[model samples]
Target chain A: MISIDWYLALSAILFCIGIVGVLIRKNAIVIFMCVELMLNAVNLSLVSFSSHYGNVDGQILVFFSLAIAAAEAVVGLAIIIAIFRNNFSVDITQINLLRW
Target chain B: MITYSFIFLAVLAVATALGLVISKNTVNSALFLVLNMVSLSGVYLLLQAQFLAIIQILVYAGAIMVLFLFVIMLLNIDEEESLFNKFRIKYFVAFLLGVGIFAQLIYSIGSFSDTLPVVSAQMAEAGTVEAIGDVLYTKYSLPFHIIAMLLTAAVNGALLVAQHKTKPLTEEND
Candidate 1:
């Protein structure tokens, strides 16, 4: 039987990858994808814990999290599109109009 | 069998995530994210989250990713520059910080001496759609309604934000 630690470890690794992606990548969409990866990693851990405890609460939380993620994606992509419309680019470094 | 499946799904998940990061083309990155989401759903199934497995594929892979791709195509963005062409000290520091956070998480997880409880029949039932609906409707009903409202707001907000506004004819004359 696989230990829950293994799943948790995997979650950590995926989350870290997301962090690195977010930090190093310049494209706004890629950064958004990295955030999604981090969210999925958390969902994986939550599901594992829910199974470990023989309870439904964690799964319920995951369900809510999934909904929120979808909503975030919709709004976030819309914002990115709006930015691209005005700026003609999605590179994060280039969209520094607010930088003083 | 389960262990082997877990290992395979875990490796696939990590690999696709890395692919999403490393690919230069935004379209390729989007495709990689789709693959990553699919692999994660496989992991969800391994964890006995049957309902979530389906939702992950449907909501994430099916709906959200399609939106990403649609925007990518609609925008027709150019491929990004090479990853390290403009590497700065700040990026290196960020990488180190990510590594530090990962190590901290791993160390904390390692320090836990107590093993997770074995999966019982009740745990298996908790993953079912019926069981989740039961709890979601009863104990978490308010949150459920809130989520519905949030979704509606998100849809309206996205439409409002993304709509193209025509420039005033007088402003164009200026």
Candidate 2:
């Protein structure tokens, strides 16, 4: 039988990678993708824990999280589009109007 | 059999995520994210979360990624110049933060000595659609309805944000 720790470890690794990507990537879209990666990693661990406990609650939570992720993606990408429209660039370094 | 499949899917997921980060082109990054999502669905299947696996594929790989690709193509964004050109200090700090968090997580996992319960037939049944549906409708019904409203709001918000504001004729004349 596979140990639950292994799944948890994988989740941690993926989550860290997502964090690194978000911090290092310059493009807003790529940063958004990294955020999705982080969400997926969380979902993986949630499902694993659900299976481990033999409870359906964790899976149900994953369902709601997935829905929320979809909603976030929609609004986030639209914001990215709006930013692109005004600035004509999606590079984070260049879109520093808010930076004092 | 399941162990080997789990390893493969886990490796694939990690590799694709790295690819998404490394790829300079926005479209390529989006494609890598698609691959990553697909591989994660496979992992979900191995974990016996059948419904979640399907939703991961449909909602993440299918819907969200399509929107990403559409925006990437529509915008025609230029490839990023380089990953670490201007932000050496930032990249180094980010790497250190990643390593620190990873070390903490691994330490926690290592210290956890309790053996997880073995998967049984009952556990398998817990992942089924009927089981989840029962719990979701009864215990989580309020959240479900809230999610419906959230989706509706998100759609309207997206439309409002993405809508191009046309200048009045007077402004154009000026």
Q: Which one wins on DockQ?
A: 2
**DockQ class, candidate 2:** medium
- Please tell me the TM-score of chain A for candidate 2: 0.97
Output the lDDT of residue A36, model 1: 91
Task: Encode model 2's per-residue lDDT on B39-102: one tens digit a residue.
Answer: 8898888888899999999999999999899989899984767763278899899999999999
Residue A60 lDDT (model 1): 91
TM-score for model 2? 0.94
Task: State the lDDT of candidate 1 residue by residue for A9-37, as single tens digits.
Answer: 99999999999888888889889989999
Q: Write the per-residue lDDT of candidate 1 for residues B21-80, one digit (tens) a residue.
A: 898888998898899889888888887889999999999999999999998999997486
Give the C-alpha lDDT of model 2: 0.88
Q: Which ten residues in a row have the lowest lDDT in candidate 1 chain B?
A: B112-121
Q: In candidate 2, what are the lDDT values of residues A1-100, reduced to their tens digit?
A: 6788888898999999999999999899999999999999999889888887888888998999989999999999999999999898888888777865
